[model samples]
Target: MPLPRTAGSALLALALASVAVPASASSTAAAAADVRYVALGDSYASGTGAGSYSDIACTRSRNAYPALWADANDPAAFSFAACGGAKIPDVLADQVDELDEDTTLVSLSIGGNDSGFASTMLSCQYSTQSACERALRTAGEYVVNELPGELDSLYATVRARAPHAEVVIVGYPHLYKEGGLCLGGLSSAKRTAVNQGSDLLNETIAGRAAAAGFAFADGRPAFAGHEICTSDAWISGSNVHPTAEGHESAYLPAFSAAVSGN
Candidate 1:
C-alpha cells in the first residue's frame, strides 16, 4: 500500500508546515507587542515649556519625552499621568493608579518640584543675593534630609503597582553652564550654586533609583551645553523648563538609551 512518490512528498511538506515557530522569533514578537508604558512625575515629565499642551490643566505637552517615545515606538498602551507642579505625594496619590501588573515600562522626572525648585529659582532671579543664597540652602537641605525618603516610598509603591515594569528615574539638568557668560541673568556665583543643587538632587535620585533596582537617566551630561544661559539655550527663560528642542534632542536620547540598556 505504498503511496505514489509525488503524493508522499506533498504529505512531508504539510507535516513540516505544522511545526511551531522558533523560540527566539516568538519571544521577539511578544516583546514588541507587550510594551504598556506609563509616564508619571512633575512638569519636567509633562513638558510644561515644550508647549502643544494636550491637557492645559496639567500642562501635559505632546512634545514631552514620554509622548515622543510613545510616538516613535508605538507601545501597546500609553498612560501619560505626569502633571505640572506635581510632588512625590501627588504622584503617589494621583499617578500610580495608571499603573498595574500589566504595565511593562515607566518613566518619570520628579524631586525637583518637591525641593521648592521654582521658589529657589525665582529668588535667584529676582531677590537679593543673600535671599537667593538662603533659598538655595533651604532647598538643598530638603533634598538631602527629606527627598530620599519620599522617593523611596514613591518608588516602592510604583513597584508594587507595576510589579513587572522597567522603571526609569529621569534626573534634572544643570540650569546654567558653570562658566558660560550672559549679560543680564543670574550672577556667576548664583549659577554655580544652582548647578550644585541640581547635582545634589541628581545624585540623591540616582542613588535611590539604584537601591530600588530602577534605571536612572542622568540628564545633566546630555544637557551640558544647552542649559538656560547658552546662546542656543534648550531651556526656556520664563520657567526654566526644557524647550521642545531640549525634549527631543536631550531628554529623548538619554531616556531612550536607558530603556534600551545602553
Candidate 2:
C-alpha cells in the first residue's frame, strides 16, 4: 500500500537532506574552518610602500595583503612575520619559526631582495642607460641561476615545518606600464628592461612553487593597467612597491583567489 501524504513528504525531505551537501564541499568547509595562516617573506609581503606601518623597523603594514585577507576571512589564527629587506637567509632564520605542523595556510613573496632589487632600481633611475642595463642583467642572471636553489631550499624548509599547510607563493608586478607616457620616471627602455626583469623573477618563483607542489599567485595581471606609469597607478611613487590601493585591490584578490582555489 502507498504511504500517507505526510509520511511521503517526510521521506522526500530526508532523501534530499542526505545528498544536500557533497563530500568535497563539506571537506573544503572543514578545512577552511581549521585554517591557521602565516604570512612570510620580504618588503612586498610586509607592505613596504603600502603605508600604515605596524612595525617601522620591519615595515609591517596593517594594509598588507596578508592582513587584509586575514581580516576578511577571520582565520583560526594568523601570524604576520614578513619584514622589509628580508632575503632568503633572513626568512629561513626568522620567519620559518612561525610555522609548525598546525599551520594550515602560508603565503610568501621573496627572491627580489636576493637579486639586489633596490640597488638595481636605484641604478636604473639615477644612473646612465648602460648602468641600468648592467644592473638588470646582473639581476636577471641571479634570477635564472641562483634563485632556484635558494627558493627550493626555502620551500623544502616550509614544507617540513608546516607539513599540512597550503603554501601560496605570491609574485611581484611589473613596475611600469610599457608604451605609456610619464613625466619623470624611468625612460621607456629602462622601464621595459625592469618589467622584463620582474617577469623573469616571477616566472622563476612560479616554477619553484610548482615543483614544491604549492600554489603560485601571479600578481602581474592584477596590476596590468595600474602600473607605475599609468594615470591611476597602483604602485607608490617609489615605482617599486605597491600602494595601499594596490594591496587592497591587486594583491589581496590574487592571494585570496589562490587560497580559495578560485
TM-score of 1: 0.89
Cα shift from native, residue 47, model 2 (Å) = 0.7
Q: Over the stretch 1-262, how does candidate 1's per-residue lDDT look in tens digits?
A: 9999999999998776655455666776677689999999999999999999999999999999999999988788999999999999899889999999999999989999899998999999998889889998999899999999999999999999999999999999999877756677888888898898899999999999999999999999989898877888999877799999999999999999999644
Off by over 4 Å in 2: 1-32
Q: What is candidate 2's CA lDDT for residue 8? A: 100
RMSD of 2: 3.2
Candidate whose lDDT is highest:
2
How much is 202 displaced in model 2, in angstroms?
0.9
- Shift in Å, residue 46, candidate 2: 0.8
What residue runs in model 1 are displaced by over 4 Å at the alpha carbon? 1-29
TM-score quality measure for candidate 2 = 0.89
Model 2 per-residue lDDT tens digits across residues 102-219: 9999999999999999999999999999999999999999999899999999999999999999999999999898875677888888899989999999999999999999999998
